[model samples]
Target chain A: MIRKLCIIGVGLIGGSAARRARRFCEEIVGIDADPENLRRAETLGVIDQGCASLERGVAAADFVLIATPVGAIEPLFRALAPLWRPDCIYTDVGSTKGNVVEAALRVFGIVPPNFIPGHPIAGAERSGVEAADARLFEGKRVILTPLPESAPDALARVEAFWMHLGARVERMDVGHHDEVLAATSHLPHVLAFTLARMLGRKDEQAEIFRYAAGGFRDFTRIASSDPKMWLDICRANRGPLLELLGEYETALREVAGLVRSDDADGLYACFSEARAAREKFLKSTENNHA
Target chain B: MIRKLCIIGVGLIGGSAARRARRFCEEIVGIDADPENLRRAETLGVIDQGCASLERGVAAADFVLIATPVGAIEPLFRALAPLWRPDCIYTDVGSTKGNVVEAALRVFGIVPPNFIPGHPIAGAERSGVEAADARLFEGKRVILTPLPESAPDALARVEAFWMHLGARVERMDVGHHDEVLAATSHLPHVLAFTLARMLGRKDEQAEIFRYAAGGFRDFTRIASSDPKMWLDICRANRGPLLELLGEYETALREVAGLVRSDDADGLYACFSEARAAREKFLKSTENNHA
Candidate 1:
C-alpha cells in the first residue's frame, strides 16, 4: 500500500486519481494553482489535505502523480528536480509521453529512475475538481512508457496503482505511444475542433447548428473538451499529428473525387471499408469491456 | 385524418415514419425492394400491410411518403408519376433537397404540386426496419424545401404530418437547405469516414484502434452509419461538400502551421474558440428541447 500519495493539479484527471487512491493510500495530498480547486478537492474527499506549495505536497509522499496538462509537465518537473526523491515512485498522466520524457531529461540532466510516464485513456468533456469521479479510470487503459532508466520496482508499483483503480495496464515505447496516440486521440480532437470552428464561422452558423443531427453532435463532441489541455497535446505531438493529418487530407481528396465523378462503386468501397473498420473497432472494445 | 398512407423504401426512416403515422392514419402500406425488410416491418407492426408492387401500394393511398435514399428518389418519382394522384399529398424524406427537386423536374416535367420535399434531421448509425424507433423524430428538426409548384394544402399537410411525429418543421429554399446540411452534416460525415479509413489502413491499425478512447469513439461513431446511404448523400450534395472540404483543408493547414511553429497562443485561440462555439451550440440545443 502507498503510505502517502500526492497529486499535482486537482483538475478532473488529478482529482479522480486522488479519489480512487483513497482506498489504496494512507493519505492523499493535492496541490493546485487554484485555491478554489484545492478546497473543492479536499471538501469532496478527493484529497486528505490540500497544498499550495509543490515541495510541501511532495514532502513525505511515497507516490507523486503529476496529473496536469501536457504544457505544465516541464515546469513541474523542473521544480520537482530540486526535491527529487529516489525512494518515491513518480508518474504522470500526460497525453504525450515523448514530451514528458524530454522534460525529465532536460530538468534533471539525467532521466530519473523513478519517473514513469503514463497516460490514462479516459476523460470527459467536463473539467475542474468537482467533475472528478472515483470511477473515471474503471475499465480504461493506462499506457506506461518506461524509459531505460526507469526502476523496475517503481514501474511495477505504478502499474499496480492504476490496476487498483480498475484500469488495464500496458507498456509501450515512448515514440510509439506518441504516434499511436496522435492517430487515435490527438488527430480526432484536431478534426473535431477544426470542423466545429469551420461550421461555427459560417454566415448561416446558427441555422447550420440548429439543423445538425445526432451524428454531427457525436462527431464533434470532442470539440467541447478543454482547449488548453488539447493545445498542449497538439504542440507536444505535432510531428505524428501533422503526418496523419496529411494522409487524411489525401484520403478526403480521393473520396471527394469519387463523389465529383459519380463513382458509385469507388464511393461505396471507401465508405463500406470505413464502416467495416469502425464496426470491428466497436466489437473489439465491447469484448474488452465484457 | 388520412384514410390511407403509403410508405416506399421502408427502412429505418421509412419504418419510423410508418410507426409514428399509425396513430394518425387509418392504414399504412409499406413497399420495399427487400422482401426481408418488408416482412420485418410487418412482423414488427411498423406497417399494417406490406406490398412488393409499387402500383398496388399507392393505388388507394391519399398520402404517399417516399422515404428512399437520395439516389433512388428519381426512379421512384418516375414510377410514381405514371400513377400520379392529384388528390394525394406526396412528400419525400430525401437527404438533399436540390437533388430531389431536380429528380422531380427530370421525371415529371415539373415538381408535382403535391410533391413536397422534406428531410428530417434525425438518424442513427444503425439502420434497417428492425432498428426503427417510433420516437426517432421526436424533438428533431425537419427541413421542408417546397418548390413554387407545391400546392399550399399539400405543403401544410406534409408539415402537419411531421408535427404529428413531434418534429419542428422549418421551410427553406432547396439550394439553401443543401448548403446548410453540407456544412452541418455531410462535411462532418466525410471527415469521420476519411479519418477512420486512413487509420484503418495503417500498419499498426489494430494497435491504433485498441488505444482509441471515448472521444475517438464518439467522434467517429457516424463512420459506422450505412455506407450506401452516406455515399448517396455525398454524391447528391457533392458541390457544397467539396467547397466546404476545400475550406476545411485550408483551415487544417493553418492549424498545422500553428502546431509546427509552436505558436501556443494561436493554437489555444483556435481550440478555445471552437470550444466556446460548441458549448454555445449545446446550450442552444438544450434550450430548444426545454
Candidate 2:
C-alpha cells in the first residue's frame, strides 16, 4: 500500500485519481496552481489534504501523479527535479506519452528510474474538481510507456496502483503509444473541432443546427470537450496527427470523386467496408470488456 | 380520418411512420422490394396489410408515403406518376429535397400539385423493419420542401400527418434544404465514414481501436449506419455535399497548419470557438425540445 500519494494539477483527472487512490493510500494530497480547485478537491473529500506548494505536496509521498496538460508537464518536471525522490514511484496521466517522456529527459537529462509515463483512456467533457468521480477509471485502459531506465519496481507499483483503481494496464513504447493515440483520439478530435467550426461559422448556422439529427450530434460531441486540453494534445502529437490527417483527406477526396462521378457501386464499397470494420472493432471491444 | 395510407420501402423510417400512423388512419398498407421485410412489417403490426405490387398497395389509398432511399425516389415517382390520382396527397421521406423535386418534375413534366417532398431528420444506425421504433420521429424536425405548384391543402395535410406523429414541421426551399442538410448531416456522416475507414484499414487496427475511448466511439457511431442508404444520400446530394467537403477540407488544412507551426494560441482559439458554438447549439436544441 502507498503510504502517501501526491497528485499535481488537481482537476478532473487528478481529482479523480485522488478519489479512487484514497482506498489504497494512507494519505492523499492534491496540489493545484488554482487555489479554488485545491480547496474544492479537499472539501469534496477527493483528497485528504491540499497544498499550493508542489514541494510541500510531495514532501513525504511515496507516489506522485502529474495530471497536467501535455504542454505543462515539462515545466512541472523541472520543478520536481530538485526534490525528486528515488524511492518514490512517479507517473503521469498525460494524453500523449512521447511528450511526457521528452519532458522528463529535458528536465533531468534523462528519464529518472522512477518516472513512468502513463495515459488513461478515459475522460468526460466536463473538467475541474467538481466533476471528479471515483469510478472514472473503472474498466478503462491505462497505458504505461516505461523508459529503459525505469525501475522495475516503480513500473510494477504504478501498474498495481491503476489496477487497484479498477483500470486495466498495458505497457507500450512511447512512440507507438503516441501514434496509436493520434489515429484513435487526436485525429478524431481534430476532425470534430474542424467540422463544428466549419458549420458553426456558416451564414445558415442556425438553420443548419436546427435540422441536425442524432447522428450529427453524436459525430460532433467531441467538439464540446475542453479546448485547452485538446489544443495541448494536438500540439504534442502533431507529427502523427498530421500524417493521419493527410491520409484521411485523401480518402475523403476519393469518396468525393465517387460522388462526383455518380459511381454508386464505388461509394457503396467504401461505406460498406467502413461499416463492417467499425462493427468488428466494436464487437472486439465488447469481448475485451466481457 | 384518412381512408388508407400506403407506405413504400417499409424499413426503419417507413415502418416507424406506418406504426404511428395506424392511430390516425383507417388502414396502413406496406410495399417493399424485399418480401421478408414486408412480411416482418405485417407480423410486427407495423402495417395493417402487406403488398408486393405497387399498384395493389396504393389502390384506394388517399395518402401515400414513399419512404425509399434517395436513389430509388425518382423511379418510384415515375411509377407513381402513371398511377397518379388527382384527389390523393402524396409525400416522400427522401433525405435530399432537390433530387426528389427534380424526380417529380422529370416524371410528370412538372411537380404535381398534390405531391410534397418531406424529410424527417430522425434515424438510427440500425435499419430494416425489425429496427422500427414507433417513437422514432417524436420531437424531431421534419423538413417539407413543397414546390410552387404544390396544392395548399396537400401541403397542410402532409404537415398535419407529421405533426400528429409528434414532429415539428418546417417548410424550406428545395435547394436550400439540400445545402443545409449537406452541412448538418451529410458531411458529418461522410467524415465519420472516412475517419473510420482510414483508421480501420491501418496495420495496427487492433491496437488503435483497443486504446480508443468513449469519444472516438461516439464520434464514429454514424459510420455504422446503413451503407447503401448513405451512398444514396451522397449521390443524390452530390453538389452541395461536394461544395461543403471542399470547404471542410480547407478548414482542416488551416487547423493542420496551426498544429504544424505549433501556434498554441491559434489552435486554442479554433478549438475554443468550436466548443462554445457547440455548447450554444446544444442549448438551443434543448430549449427547442423544452
Candidate 3:
C-alpha cells in the first residue's frame, strides 16, 4: 500500500500535487531547499511535515516525486538513489522525458522497475508554492512515458494517483513523446522568448510594453516563465526542439517570401488554413479523453 | 464643439468606441453594412441611432470615424466622400495606416485636414458587436498617425477624446507607425499563424491538441483570430512584415543549427537570455503609472 508520499522541490506542481494527494495519502512530506517555500507549503497544508534536507524527506516514503529543475533531476536522483528504500516507487514532474530517463540511468545502476516517467501538461507563468492550487491539474492531461522494464503495477499506481487529482492520464513512447511536446510546447516557448527578446530592448520596450493588449500579453506571457527551468528544458530536449524549430523556420520563410513578393492570394490562403485549424482544435477536447 | 459622433462598421472596436464616446459626445450614431450588428449596437445602448448607409452616418456628424477593415475602409470613405460635411472631422481605426491614408487620398479629391489615422492598441481575439465593451479602451494606448497637413485642433481633439475614454494617446508618422507595429504586432501574428499552420494536421492534431497546456494556449491563442482580417493586414503591410519575418527566421535558424549540432550550452544560453529579457519587460510593466 502506497500510504506515504514524499515530494521534493515543493513549488507550484509539487505543492499542488501534495495538496491533491492529501485526500488519499495518509502522510505527505515536502522537501525544499528554499526556506520560504517550505514555510509557504506548510502554511498551505500541502504537506504534513516539511523537511529542509532531502534525507529527512525521503525517509518513510512509499513514493518519491522529484520536482526539481530538469538539469537538477539527474544529480537529485543520484543523491537519493542509495538512500531511497528499495520498495519505494519514484517518479518526476519534468516537462521533457528522454533526458530525464537517460539521467536516471546514469545515476541509478540498472533502471528501477518502480520508476515511472511522468509529465503533467499543466502550469502557469507565475510559479512557486504561492501560486500552487489543488485544482491546477483539474481537467488537465498528465502524460506518462513508462519504460518496458517499468513495473505495470507501479505505472498503474502513478496513473491512479494523477487521475484522483482530476488529471486525464495518457501513455506514449519516450521518443515520440519528446517530438510531440517539442511541436506543442518547446517550439512555442522558443518563439515567445525570441519575440520577447527582440521586442524587449530598453529603447523600444516602453512603446512595445505600452502597446501590449490582451493578445500580446497572452502570447508572450510564457516568455516570463522561470529562466533556469527553461534553460534546463532547452538543454535536455535540444534535439526535438531543434527539429520543430526548423519546421517553424520553413513556414516563416515561406510566408516571408510570399510577403516580399506581394503574393496576397498565397498569404490569404495560409492564414485561412491556420485559422480554421485553430478553431477546430480548440472546439474539441474529446480526443483528450481517448 | 464635437457634440455628435459617427462611427462606421459597428463591430467590436467601432461599437465600443461609440459607447465610450457617449461619455464625451452628446450623440453617437453607428453605421454598419451588417444590419444585425447595427441593430445589436442600438439595443446595447452603444449608439444613439444606427444607419445602414455611410452617407446617413457621416452627413450631420461633428466627428466621423471609419472603423472598417483595411480593405473596406477605402471603399467606405470613397462612398461617403461626396456626402461628407465640410466641418466634420474624419478619422479611421485601421491596423495599417499607410495603405488606408494612400487609399483615402487616391479616392477623395482632397483629403480633409481633420482626418487622423489612429489605432487603439486594445482588443480581444473574440470579435463581433456582442463582445464589445466600453472599457475596452480604458488604460490602453491609442496611437495616432498624423499627416503634415492635419489640422492641429482636430488631432488634439481626437487625442483628447481617447484620453477622456481613459486611453493614453501617442503620435507617430504613418510610415514609422507601420514599421513599429509590424515588428511588435504584425510579425507576432504572422509567427502565430505560421506555427499553427505548420503543426496543424488532421491525424496528429488530436494528440497535439490534447497535450496543449499553458504555453501552447498562450502562444497560439492569436492564431485563432479572424483570418480575413489578418490576411488583409499581411497584404497591406507586406514590406515591413516580410522584413520582420526574415529577422525572426534568422533567430530561429541559429537556434535550430545549434540544436542540430547538439550544442546544449548554446541552446541553454539562448533560452536563458531570452527568458531574462522577457522577465525584465514584465518587471518594468509593473512599475508603470498607467
Candidate 4:
C-alpha cells in the first residue's frame, strides 16, 4: 500500500527491486547519475519514471531504497537527510553495514529513525539495468543492520518490503554483520580477485586458462564481478576484511607447511575436513533454498 | 584398435575413459583394490569386466591405462613393465606428470618408450566410478607430457585415443605441465580448502554460511572436491604447488598492504585487472564451449 517507492542507482540491484516492487507499490521512481541507466530502467518498465536528481524523485515517496554502492550510501544519506520526509521509511542494500552506519553517524550526529541499513544477499557477475531480474531476491536473504535510532515501525516496514520481494529477512548488529561477511563474502572475493589477477599477469596465462578445468573456473567465478563496485566494497569494509585476510593467510600458511613438510597425513586431514565442511554447507544451503 | 584396454583404479577418470572407449576398444578391463567400486563400475556398465589382479588383467592387453593415484603409478608401471609384452603401449592419466615420469625412470633406470604421461583436464566434485560420465572429457583439454625416450607412435596413439573420446589434445613437457596445473588448478584448490576449513572451524560458522551468497558458494565450490584424490594430487605436485602458493600469498600480501594503506587506486587497479582478466577468460571459454 506504499504510495511511491524511490530506488536510487537503478542498476542490477536497484532495478531488480523496482521490478519486483512494481506490483506492490502505487508508483516506482528510479534515480541515477547515469542517464543511460535511468533510461534503460524506465524503458524496461522497471520503474514508472526516471529522475536525474534524488531530491526530486524522492520528494513524494513513502518508501525509499538506497541501492547505491557502499561508498555512495553515506553521501546519499547525508544529501537526503533534510529532504526526506519524516514519514518515509528508508533502507539500503549495501554489502557493508559498518561503514554505512558510521557514515550516518558522521553526517547526522545521530542515526535517523527511518533509515534502516540493509544488504540484499543477491547478485550476479553481470551489472547495469540490463541484467535486472524480478526474481533476483526470491529466496535470497536480506540482512538489516539497524541503528539505535531506528524506529520499530520503520524497521518493520523495511522488513515487510523485503519479505514481499520474496526474501528471508535477517537482523544483526553492524559489527557482527561486518565480521560475518568479512569471512564469507569479502575474503573469498579478495582471493578470487588475487588468483585471477595473478594468473592474468602471467606469460602463460592463455594456455593456463585454456587448461583450467571446471574446478578452477568455479573457484575464480566471483573474480568476474563488477570491479568498481567490488573496489568500493573492499575499501568500505577494509578493517574487517584485513582481519579476515589474516585468518585466511594463517590457514593457507598451515596448508603450505603441511605440504612443504610432506605431511601426507596432515594434508589428507586438512583436505578431508574442508571437503566435509563444504559438503555440509552445500547440503544446508540446498535444503534452505528448496 | 586396442584389443583389450586395461584400466587400473577404475574411478571417475578411468571409468569415464572406459565408458567412452568401449566403442573404440574391443574390451575394457577394470582394476581396483576396492571390490565394491569394481562391482559398482561393472553394474553401471562403465567396465566390461573387473580385474582383481594387476598381473592377470593387463597380461594380454594391447593398451594399458594406469589410472591409479599418482603415487601408485610407479609401482603399477614397475609391476607391468616386467610382465607386459614390449608391443603393449602404456599411458596414465595422473594429474602430476613429473612424479609419474620420475617413477618410471626410477623403477626401470630409463624412461619407458611405451609410456606417455597424460592428464585429462576434466572432473566433477563427485568421485568414484558411479559418478563417471562419458561426456566429461568432451570439449575438455587433455595434456600429454611425453619423455624423450617415449616412442612417437605411443604418443600418437595416446593423442588419438583422447581425441576419439572428444577431448582436445595438447602436448607439453612434464615440468611445464606441472607448473601450469599448479598455478591454475592446485593453488585454487588449496585456497578453496583453506577458506572453507577456516570458516567451517569457526564458532559462528553456521551463521556465516547461512548468510553466504552465490559469490562465496562459487568461490569455494571446489572445496567439495574429492579429498583423497585431491590430497594425492597435492602430494604428487607438491613442488609446483608450493611455488604457486608462495606466489599467491605474495599477491595476497600486496593486496592487504594496499588495503591497510588505504590505497584506493591500487585496490581499484587490482580488482579491475582481475575483473577484466576473468571476463576475458569467461568470454573465450564460452566461445570455445559454444
The per-residue C-alpha lDDT of model 1 at residue B152 equals 96
- Encode model 4's per-residue lDDT on B106-139: one tens digit a residue: 8888887888889998888888888898998998
- Global CA lDDT of candidate 4, please? 0.87
Model 1: docking quality category: high
lDDT of 2 by residue, A210-240 (tens): 7787887889899999999998899888899
What CA root-mean-square deviation does each model show from the true structure? 1.3, 1.1, 2.8, 1.4
- Candidate 3 C-alpha lDDT tens digits along B1-290: 46778888888888888777777788888888889888988998888899876766777788888788777877777787788766878888888888988887888755578788899887777888888888988877789999888899889888887888788888988888888888767888888888888878622534576677767877888998888788888888887787777777777777667667767777667766777776665665564434
Off by over 4 Å in 2: A203-206, B203-206
Which prediction has the highest DockQ against the true structure? Answer: 2
A7-43: candidate 1 lDDT, tens digit per residue? 9989999988877888979999989988987888888
Q: Candidate 4 residues A49-151, lDDT tens each? A: 9988777899978999988887788778778877967889888999998898888889888788888999998999888899899999999989999877799
Indicate whether candidate 1 or candidate 3 has the larger TM-score. Answer: 1
- Tell how far residue A50 is off in model 1, in angstroms: 1.0
* Candidate 2 lDDT tens digits, B199-242: 88883435578788889899999999999999989988999999
Model 4, position B217, has a per-residue lDDT of 83
lDDT of 1 by residue, B67-109 (tens): 8888898888778888998989999998898998888889988
Worst 10 residues of 3 chain B by lDDT: B201-210
